[model samples]
Target: MNKILRSFTLFTALSAASVGVHAGNYWTASAQDGWIDGYVEATLLLSGNLDASGIDTDVDDGTVTLRGKVETDIDKALAQELALGVDGVIGVENMLTVFSPGDNDDAAKQRKLTDEKVATVVKTRLMVAPNVTSADIDVNSTKGVVVLQGKVKNDAEKQRATEIATKASDVEKVVNKLSVSE
Candidate 1:
């Protein structure tokens, strides 16, 4: 009976230790995943062809997986490359699908190009403006409509951003979604 009791106690202790180890590993993995998600997001945002809001990223043990829809295969490939380039990323599994093919019409292509140009110009204007940190602002353009989404220092900063976006060539509308700092 004593031997049996010793054996059962050993088993219980070992099992508890195993559970603790597993919990520790789980927390470590969770933190790593959060960091990887943020890194992937920043990478996607830095890519000119990719819209970060449209992509979802998951990370497990230094392996980054991308799951989302992009406008073209090139954008998918670019996302994979960007994720792979992250410092701690050991591999990238790209499962992104192209949701829309390129418009075959010349007019549509021109319009898309123009919208991109206008957004870029507006972003540049904000970058050069006094007291405006362009990095805090997100600019997106579609069909000649420029959308500004971000937080600014004050009401003046928000109005300045709107003015800069409005002055961009070919911008038909400015949707200012900027909020003042609290």
Candidate 2:
């Protein structure tokens, strides 16, 4: 009876361990692509040497595919390198086009500056808004498109936040992903 009981206990433990391992893998595999995409975008956006306004990042099964326009060859390579530096990014397919600005260098620079200014203006407005809780909110802009993320107190606060961002100068659109806290 003792031998039988010990064998049964061991079997149960082994079965549980196997299930845990498989479950962990299943979740990790499913969620990894989205996480990698976000990481790569953040990495490219924060890179001072690269203008990521026109760059689109996509991830599939640990591979990052970069699409869109870059100012120069160096910028294209830098974008790829930044994406590859992200954790869980096993490979990068650089499909970035080198844009020839001709005499439009000044225009290109102005666009980049505008994107930065748009984000700053939106953030400042949120901070001073009486009804909005700006502490938990994050702001990002690219080519006049503003992305608002983070938590808000309620639905009213979320709508108010979006309205504030939309009113900011040079913001062509606002993508609100603010979650209401319970």
Candidate 3:
């Protein structure tokens, strides 16, 4: 009885600790995540052996994205339902795809190239954007292609800036480093 009680206490303590670590707006871009602690816990439980241990869910904004590996379709469904039930998750975009147990490098490489292409396209699009002045938009590139940094009027403008910067081009990815106020 003592051993069981001790184990339960430990589990509770660890769960609380995980939530404490992810209580900031630094994880994602939406505003709803700040109030959804249970969502984070649900995701952690459903991750099974999938390794998203570092995946932060403390995004002060509402945007919550959950990524991990699941062996069975049932597990996937449960995780999705739990994620959707979370307070701040307006949408749950499944990027998990499927992961075969064996070694796979093709998908990884493709992701790199796609990210680069997105960056390139986003850069080109932003350069010619209607209200955007490219001179102020600092763009950076890695294997992923583009990362935008600067300030914009609002989220709409920021999104537009990202869109113009990441249009269908050679770019593989576009990182919106842009900031917004009102």
- Tell me how many clashing residue pairs each candidate has: 0, 0, 29
Q: Once model 2 is optimally superposed onto the true structure by TM-score, how far is the C-alpha of residue 157 displaced, in angstroms?
A: 0.5
Give the winner by TM-score.
1
Candidate 3 residue-wise lDDT, 107-154, digit = tens = 654454344334433444455467775556666656646778987767
**Pairing residues by index, what is the TM-score of model 3?**
0.31
- The pairs that clash in candidate 2 are none
Residue ranges of candidate 1 with Cα displaced over 4 Å? 100-182
Higher-scoring candidate on TM-score, 1 or 3: 1
For model 2, residues 69-151, the per-residue Cα lDDT tens digits are: 98876677667756765557899999999985333356665576567556655775676579999999999989989999999
| True-structure lDDT of candidate 2 | 0.80
Q: Candidate 2, 82: how far from true, in Å?
A: 29
Alpha-carbon deviation at 119 in model 3, angstroms: 6.7
Where model 2 places Cα greater than 4 Å from the true spot, the runs are 1-104
How accurate locally, in lDDT, is each candidate?
0.77, 0.80, 0.54
